[model samples]
Target chain A: MEESNWEPKVIGFLCHWCSYAGADLSGSARLEYPHNIRIIRIPCSGRVDPMFILRALQNGVDGVLVSGCHPGDCHYQSGNFHARRKFAVINRLLKYVGIEPERVQFSWVAASEGPKMAQVIGEFVEGVRKVGPNRLFKDEKKDGE
Target chain B: MENRLKEEAGKLLKEGKVDYIVGYGKGTVNLRTSPLITNKEEDLEGLVINPFIANNLSRYPVELKGRVGIVVKGCDSRSLTSLMQDKKVKREDLIIFGVPCEGVVDLKKLAGQIGAEIDRVTDAEKEGENLTLQVDGSKKTIPFRDVIFDKCYGCEHPTPLEYDMLLGSEVAPNLDIEKSLERIKELEGMDAQERWNYWKEQFSKCIRCYGCRNVCPACFCERCFVDVNMPQWVATYATWQDNLTFQLIRTLHVAGRCSDCGECERACPVGIPLRSLQRKMVEEVKDLFGHEVGIDKDAPPVFSHYEATDPDEFMK
Candidate 1:
């Protein structure tokens, strides 16, 4: 895999009240994970529109992770539940299109799960590395390479 | 055709009752007549009714300014009825010239049938029952039932269910309804996991163009869920899961209000069978409330009126 010469670019969308705080705890605890991930904080995981995921793929992101509160622990009470249903539907669609489902990940992360957050990110980064960069929609007709 | 409708339109336009008249006119494009909007009397000469016209002109009334006179066919009038049902347009807003349409032809299907490309076409003659179509180069006569849209084939009513001015002789309503509901029945009968898998396969290919919503007459919300920013329903990704969420939510919102116009299915560039999904909801509405949209202008929308005896099949 080292000789494959592929670096994965992962985009993480973490809900503000849960996953984002868990991520902050991971940094505070000095936990180490792959540094290839770029995090975008959102109000709630439910706020992540499906278009955001497609746009990232179109812009050449290798993998996308959407982390929110656990099923029953969403700050807004039922936001995570809605997000779960949405992710299930979107995940099934990607599988149908022959896109490796591993490229998209959904996880439940509460504010206290610092070590778990680091572990999740590390596992996602490793999985993405094995899968390699997503060149599925990358522009091949660049005027100057 | 109704002489009263022409007289009313002519009187309204002559009296400056409307800024323009929007109706079906001669096809300038290949084998397809479009919704023609006119401010001049000369343009009204092109108006003819036999039933090759197939456009929902309801959207123009919402967008265009000033008073407008519109010709409403059976399905086209349904669009108007839906708009009125939703309070989107008022009866006094414009003059309506209703045409009793047997059914409109599906131009896309007709184009495939005839090898020769059609530059322009119209339903020129109706000899007893058969409709004669004059295309760019040649004239082909086809049985009215054979060439019209499938939705129209099973049409329970040939006259505009609601219209201000009746233009043509009203044809007896053809009550063959379930022919269109067959596919919906097949899908609804499938087990949950099977249905899920089937839909997963279908929604995965969707590009999320919003064409289905845009073309639907019932979906008149100024700001759709796709544009909502407060708590976005789905991500802006083309991924299968996101597309599923978008469609499921949108479909649920339009459950009872949809008239099964088939515009969503036609507008789909990738040719997804959206009508099947829509038909399922239509069945549910009928089963629950015995309510069919656009059929009766007096009945309140299903969602707007709650029933104490509503089914709780999906409720936990």
Candidate 2:
């Protein structure tokens, strides 16, 4: 297959105990995945404030993926659970305001699910490509002044 | 109603129950009311209630230091509840004088009807359904419905929902839930790109005055995210991106907390239809979490506490 000229810029906010470890394991296991995502490790998914996702979009990132531990599996016992509820409201609000629903994605990736993390990244990049570059709230300041 | 309000306010001050009364007094400009804080019994004469009393006096109790007797209409009373929930003001510190509101006039709408700048409104009175306004030397009497603020048309509580003392008889709510949701429904019917363009046009007009934020009773944060400089949560520029960020973040911050008092919309100088954004969140909170803000002070904020069975259909 010919490589596409477009490469979507994806920002992944990964919980340290779960999704971050999962991404690291994917690296150690040499599982190939799209290089589109730039990972930001956070203490817990609950720490991923909706502002961060919105800021990333405003800064012209093509997509945002927030991954945390599955329910009942959070290291802090309830962080991911709390994050799940917040993401639900944020996602709905974004969609209601005319943002592409696919621009912001949420999922659960346990520490051991290295291949799963790779799959999530690949799919998110593809989905964002289908929607094209995000112009919603994009900063209009010219690059490098 | 005005005489009763003044008498009750005087009684509260004369009895030394409150250090001051937060009510509306005559503004420097005619036909305008300003938030007045007074402790003198004689000053109660300045306290007035009219269709022009658009100021929400709820935030005064939180900002002022001392026992305050605040005059609250239905919407103002709800805002007081939100303040109490946030611990910004204590119930004991406030002597709430509840007034049954018959809707306040929208100054802009009235100005538009008159067709010229109102240099001064010599006199104004609401008699039954007609608003008699003495503009300059000519008197214009318009139907009250034609000049009343849009927020009042769908008021669910025309009288204070909760108050220590009732100043007047309870008024029946002119509750039109559909009317409140009409704008939201219209926006929802638009395609995504159309909606985006619509908001972009609106946000582009923002001057970043922060009038909406300042007027909100729920926006009691000591350091708003927009003002933070260390990590700059949102840029201070007047660009559309920054304006959109400020609005979206502020809405999220007040989700399940905003009382839908319409103060933000009323305070906006550019007429951004802020209530539309806020009401959308209000409806979403009600639909998803089954909670309405500023109703029960005992209940925790919707986002602060989550039920085990809270809907998570949007989650993976």
- Give TM-scores for every candidate, taking all chains together and pairing residue i with residue i: 0.64, 0.93
Q: Give the winner by lDDT.
A: 2
Q: How do the residues B1-316 of candidate 1 rate in per-residue lDDT, one tens digit apiece?
A: 6346556667788999898788876567744667788788766777656466777777678766888898877776776776777777766777777788777777666666655444555435666667676776468777656566667755666788777778768988765566656666676576544665666678778998989989887788899977876766566767666676677666666766777777888788877778776656665566656877777666666555444344422211
Number of backbone collisions per candidate, in order?
23, 0
Any idea what lDDT model 1 has?
0.72
Candidate 2 segments whose C-alpha is farther than 4 A from its true place: A1-4, A138-145
DockQ of each: 0.04, 0.62
Q: Is the docking of candidate 2 incorrect, acceptable, medium or high quality?
A: medium
Scored against the true structure, residue B165 in model 2 reaches a CA lDDT of 80
Worst lDDT run of 10 residues, candidate 1 chain B, spans: B307-316
Per-candidate iRMS values, in order, are: 10.3, 1.4
Model 2, range B22-131, lDDT digits (tens) per residue? 99999887888899898888888898888788998898887788999998999889888878888899989988888899898888888898886655668888899898
